[model samples]
Target chain A: MRLTRRDALAVLAGLGITGGALGLSTLDPTAADGDGSSGDRDPAETDLLATMTAAAEVVYPSQVTGVGEFVETYVTGRSRDASRQAAMETVVSELDEIARDWHGAPFADLAADDRDDLLRELGVADSEPVPEGNVSERVRFYVVNELLYAFYASPTGGRLVGIENPIGHAGGTDSYQRAAMDGGQSDVNAGENDG
Target chain B: MADERARAPVADADVCIVGAGPAGGIVAHRLAESGQNVVVLEAGPRFDGDRREQLEAHVRPGLDGPWEMGGPRDAFSSSGESFYPLNAARVKGVGGTTLHWQGMVMRLHERDFELDSRHGVGADWPLDYDDLKPYYAEAERELGVAGAMDNPYAPPRDDPFPMTAFPPSHSDSIFAEACERLGLDMHSVPSARNAEPYDGRSPCVGYGTCKPVCPSGAKYTAESHVEKAEAAGARVIDRARVRRLEHDESGERVVAAAYTTPDGETHRQAADQFVVACGGVETVRLLLLSESDRHPNGLANSSGVLGRYFMDHLFAGMGGRLDRPTRQNHVGFNTSECHQFYDDTEPVNGVKLEFLNYAGPSPVIDALHADTWGDELLEQLDESYGTHISMGALVEQLPRADNYVGLDRETTDDLGDPVPEVHWSIDDQTKTALSRANEVQASVLDELGVDVEWTVGPDNTGPAFHHMGTARMGDDPDSSVVDAECRTHDVRNLWIAGSSVFPTGGAMNPTLTIAALAVRLASSLRARLS
Candidate 1:
């Protein structure tokens, strides 16, 4: 049931969570997933998402509502696409290989700071042997960016940017200036404002 | 009086406006306000706040959504490239294509009207920039255009813009400095949006989702004018696909138009005057479909040029990491443009430099292009998302006789109407413009101390949705479809509006131009009918 923002609105509306709030979705990122319940993730699938979710957590670090659950579901949706799944598998395997070579353990098992350090090291490494095209960039854009947006993608992130109900989000809250109704004010407003 | 005698009229009015886009809406509003009966037929459904939210929801999840800005899919487009050759994210219905437009409201350069005299390539417009200046002002007033008065590149006007330009984003400052260092002129992009609430619309909150949908109606759409038209006593019928125009004997003037409803019922609407603003493609399709015993080659094809000279802008650009963190794409996006090359009439021609708008393809999407996805891909999105700045050249496309739209008699629309077969190609001028664009890209990036990581287009450069010239307006009846007033040469009372009458595709979005011309046409029709 990977609910869209529209569906999430319906569910939230049912609960009377009706104020135009962005953090409402931030409170429960996993609410977008099928059934709005976190108990249904397959153990194997959860394990696969563990590394990506942890990496996303490092980017924003739960500043508001926990983004980990929402990210897992978002990645789950990506993994469902065959092309995305292939790309993720290639990049995730490469990341796990790098972690094992660096610390004798899988990437998902690394300490939170250690995971952050791994990303930072890879961010600036001069001679790291991981190929830099598909696996290299996908690691950032696909896995990390999507994971990072899991928090930023929610209504909560839009509020931080001063837009309580950013367009493209589920909320339809409007914030307009009253004078826009006077369609005939052609020159007065034009002369008053400076670019 | 003519409408009262009609037997089974679904609707009837003094003027019947086909296509409830910016052009149709403005004409309806003007005629209705002048005490003339007007009926507007829109092929798309009406758009409102709830619909905006739903469309906005489609844009929420990155670029991997069903449609950009939640616009409906074009069932008849040719998807042979990364983007459709003719139209991508082009909309139909009540708000019309403006529902998904990015709200760029720039006027054509004054020189654009005389491209034939200036460049010796395209046909000259019947009216000059000064002739359309008043209508442009009226259109800006109607659509709420925010602009800067100091920009030398903008078209000169008597009054100031309706609103001041949007405040500079962090990216705008960087882009300005880089452009200055590179010796290129740049300024705030004149936009059809409120900088601070006006006309009951909220100022732009910089949500960066203008394409495909304006989530908060902060941006103007045809729906705004549609509402005004309705308020002025104009009746708008949505989801009414116009089939063909019926003309009187001698093929001199149009009498009525037949349109089909969503439920497959046909109805005839007669009016004293008729307007066809069915975008660039459908307008030609309708004319071709209206061919009768007297006019065998299409209703307005006496010169055999009704479907000829189709054109759209060519987009080419380069992007790389900025010297410092701009954090630009987060808000007030696409607010800068450089028109230094826009007035060039010689070798370089008009090449508009628009500041970076949307983020490029994701690493995975990019990797798919490269045929591999590796480990370092994750970090690149961060490096590029906020860290990179880009500029693109929107090169002017000179109208050519070969690029045309015609009826593909083999295919039919959902309503059994003939589909439009778009025949467009990148001409030599576009090729020259591409070469110049590449040089422009190189020089700008070098001055900014950024290396060109990826360059898109020089050959087969992407299609810009500013479709124009299928039924171009010119002084010469020998080589044009319509007169200077956008009225068809073969038909007396039938007029063409929108970009379809553009003699040349200027390096600017055609929405404002279309609205302005529609306003001018409305005045012309009012005078004629009064």
Candidate 2:
């Protein structure tokens, strides 16, 4: 989970994000997750981070590694907004209340399968993800959808779906100019050796 | 102390340029390079921070948004048939809106100069494209343009672009096939971005955030000229907003540029000659704000045409998902465009089609907004995100006196000056053009076998942020603010640059034309001084 600069570049290359890393380590902030620790963050913020990370495990693809550190970094960064902080807290508390009533545990403390079942039973996945709407909508909006967006938006998760260089990342000209091969699944080895 | 500061000249110069944008940057560099004492007053600050860090922050989700570009300092209102997002379209900083521009730079077609003479609709430019041809070449060199000479529909060029054209993106190749099928000539889009290492700046490393932010600084911003101007001995003052132009007793010449600093201290910049290059909206707003008894309408409004003839290119788009991967958001800027419909006469005046490199919702955004979650959401993104393809077109909007930028009586900015009230509307001609452009785009998309998802037609068209024709140039002083030389008809020493003086905005991007006119104006200013 803790990658050196060279290792991060190697990982980025392996992910098909960039070919022959031209100092594009900044492309994926999570790729440079040193120590993988939330150092000196506020206690309440840490709690929120934990809740979000727990939720991310259930929502994210099973293949996606480092869900904890990734969600922690993303959630901590987004918590700068007071309203977003409050919204996360509200949603987490609502989920925790449901967990306590049904499964006699906090949502973060519940098993991943049980948490997934609860989310499904609550219709959180089916509900419209309105930011200011009801509990299910808020859960869908702030937790499920937000975490999903963060994962795929990252170069690592984007590479899973043929997005070699997501939107804001600089993967160089050859990466974009090279046509996709074998349907839309991006030939990972096609232009890796080219300039 | 404030009164004392107000009376003292901030800087005395042979020439004073306001707005420090593409126009002012070019003029300042040219004049200062000629050994003239030039001073530029910019309303915005220089973004001297680490651009890579800034771009990283910008790309991050759940942040306030990209680039700390606009705020209360750039407040403006709009009221008409259609709403104009004025602040979103502009940046009031050192490079101006070019700092965040999409870097597409194309020369105006020869017929664009004779809109009235040829089409008998909009007013004709006093000077033709031939007049600007030399300056256009010079501007291309200065901005480090890259283009292919394959655009058969483009106006005749005496010289090739300064750099080689960038190869088409993977998506562009996909679109090109469809375009070829539809008999649309898709050629390389001329851009102000670097295709190779020409200037000191690096070639495009494809940071992909060309608009609002270019992390690698490959895309040309007027800040380059501003820096060159400074090195050539021009005094550049940032965060100094020019409130108004003050004329001498005769009112025939502008004597001083009265501006306020960020510290709320007012100072006057004395100059022998002045140039206002504050884009379109703010240019009119500044002139309107300087209303005096001698020229009660405004300093340059003796002809009563100062704030009239507002123009912006209306955009039409159609987007859909092809079964195969179109590879969306790969290059961030368009690499190919179609100018075949530019001179069309029937449904629209002019049109330029672009095959967008960054099409469809970003993977993150699509995942975030998808109704499904977990496995279903990932499946949806895999199917939808990369497969999305979109085509966009710029439709010509003829200048109308009623669509103008005037002083907003209600809203005031951080400087307490009345903000610009934009009265904008889409005319029937423009609406018809949008509809026609959409039809053409639909045919191409349909040819590609794309499942058409969304289409932006007349009802949902918006401006491409190419503000033009507020202070139109003409031969007659009776009907125009500036003459053929871009000098104010009323004030002999006052000059106007940028697209604001354009009589007709062709369906091309205006930055290249703006740079061309800036070069010409610099030559004119140098001649007057000599």
Candidate 3:
């Protein structure tokens, strides 16, 4: 599936990723694969996109749409970097091991509710998303945080939240002089207000 | 051993300027326009590639900075109380630092030239503000400055700016209201960026990445002048680093400049006159490396002050969050500034206040670090993203004998020559200035009912990288390297340009002053050559 910028935004809306992850600390770009090594399986052989898509369905808001094709494109692009692909592969394998131990199934094959429970049980939320830390922290950095960064950095995700254009995208002089159209009040807030 | 390498003849010219930055570009253009043979040697390659790609490099994470030129070749050592990140602040190319400079082009105040005579601190400039007034106007015209005439604290200018000033960013209006309450005036900052297209360049489209890259070509860089100089028949050779200046047997004049090419071959460019415009640090390094039997100290160092009195501007800042939306990050460059305390040089140094437009937390980064995920994450972003406001001040740093650019014998660059060692420290006077600036900033923020978040004073202050006063100009040869005319007193045919000749730097950006001096030096050379 061809993932246009629109598709990327759809994926991000579901992911609900945004800023403040990278600011925690600079992730070691060259972090080696974990010592467990996923039962000595090479990370290159792992199905990174499939595993991430299944995980996205669990973490994403129930209202979000268009998760599949965008995840495919994002994973494909991310896998081009040897280091990032290695980290993704290691974390995916570790995640699958946890799923098998807990539910007796692969992570992608588990039910959405079961997958969500496994993530919570692993204490991924409580730990800092360190690149070289334990399995849970690596999952937070590589999987959860990466998805959020890609979405908010996109034009659609930014516009959905009243940031018509993110940094680095040219918004022209008028954008600087004028106020943000929504005053940074996202559609999510509007929905809650209407309710 | 590197000197013994066979020297190839590069070019013969009436004048050879050993840098392609702002000063060198201006001098080369003015001289070449008069039909004189001119050559400019640059240490780095021209950034002639697609700028959009360069911008992408800057925005993308885990990549090197905007320029691909600053690598191992530009290494240096910092041995001061504060470790100076030398290479991060400067660029070496046809356009030089202006390629990445924020494009602020403020002029020195009248009192800046009389610091010693009036304030009894720092030596007075040999030439007053009036002497450089005409050249300042010419430089403003040449650079296509956009400014408002509302700056009451600035030195008087006879001519209007080429373009009208850009309107302040939306966030600046927020600070203006608070400043009004405190009885402080907010005026437009004079910038080299075009408000409307004047010199065949586009108006600022607000790419918001003006520091490292301006993909739209809105901000003015010296490459335009370098190109103009070339059109008028000046030869600019990029990727050629001048190793040393070779003087005559009498050591009274510079005879030739020996430089090394990328292929490690040494070449000599002979000229009737030489202008060393390679910035404050590199200029001193080149002069120190050119030591000989006759000039045991260094070339143009008869006064023993070539590398003395190094100076840079320090910053004081405060950041806070407001309840209302500030609409931050909408603009990249600042538009409003306060120069109210610029002339008050008693008890504390001068300070220039600024209201920053890019102060808030980046929405993407903020959301990513949210403790909550899903709906709660979205709520956190809505609550936190657009409410940040910040203010900053440029504090004047007085020159000290110990704060200097000396040669580091232990560290060397790609050329096997000793790198420039920056001996820098924040003095009591500078700390006092920072505290005063912070007090003023805090007052404005407090008036706006902002929740104070972080403050930057003497302990956290960093250099603005306005390198000045190393090769200070003065009337007395016993205390200075260059004379009032910017010609080296020890060497009649040698000249120095750029901020290296600034005797006392005011709390202002130094590019306009550097450009004015360059234009003046070119006029002086025209008379001598004729």
Cα-based TM-score, every candidate: 0.74, 0.84, 0.82
Tell me the tens digit of each residue's lDDT in model 2 across A53-103: 888887877666777656665664455457877888888888889989999
* Model 1: per-residue Cα lDDT over A57-115, one tens digit each: 56553343444554554555445446766666677778888999998887888997787
Error of 2 at B55 (Å): 3.3
For all candidates, state DockQ relative to the true structure. 0.07, 0.32, 0.19
Instruction: Give residue A43's lDDT in candidate 1 (0 to 100).
Output: 50
**Candidate number with greatest TM-score:** 2
Report the candidate with higher TM-score, 1 versus 2: 2
Model 1 chain B worst lDDT run, 10 consecutive residues: B364-373
Specify the CAPRI tier of model 1. Answer: incorrect
lDDT of 3 by residue, B93-137 (tens): 889999889889988998899999998899899999999999999
- Between candidates 1 and 3, which one is better according to TM-score? 3
lDDT digits (tens) for residues A1-195 of candidate 3: 122434442322222211122221112111234321223334443467778878766555455666665565455545545787888988998899889998999899999888877887888766567778799888887877667655665555555455655554444566666655543322211101100
Candidate 1: stretches off by over 4 Å: A1-17, A20-150, A154-195, B1-12, B49-52, B55-57, B60-84, B87-89, B357-384
Ranking by TM-score: 2, 3, 1
For model 2, the local distance difference test gives: 0.80
Q: Where's the lowest-lDDT run of ten residues in candidate 2 chain A?
A: A1-10
Candidate 2 chain B, poorest ten consecutive residues by summed lDDT: B56-65
Model 2 per-residue lDDT tens digits across residues B117-215: 887899899998888899999999999999999999998899989999998888888887877777889899999998888678778866567877786
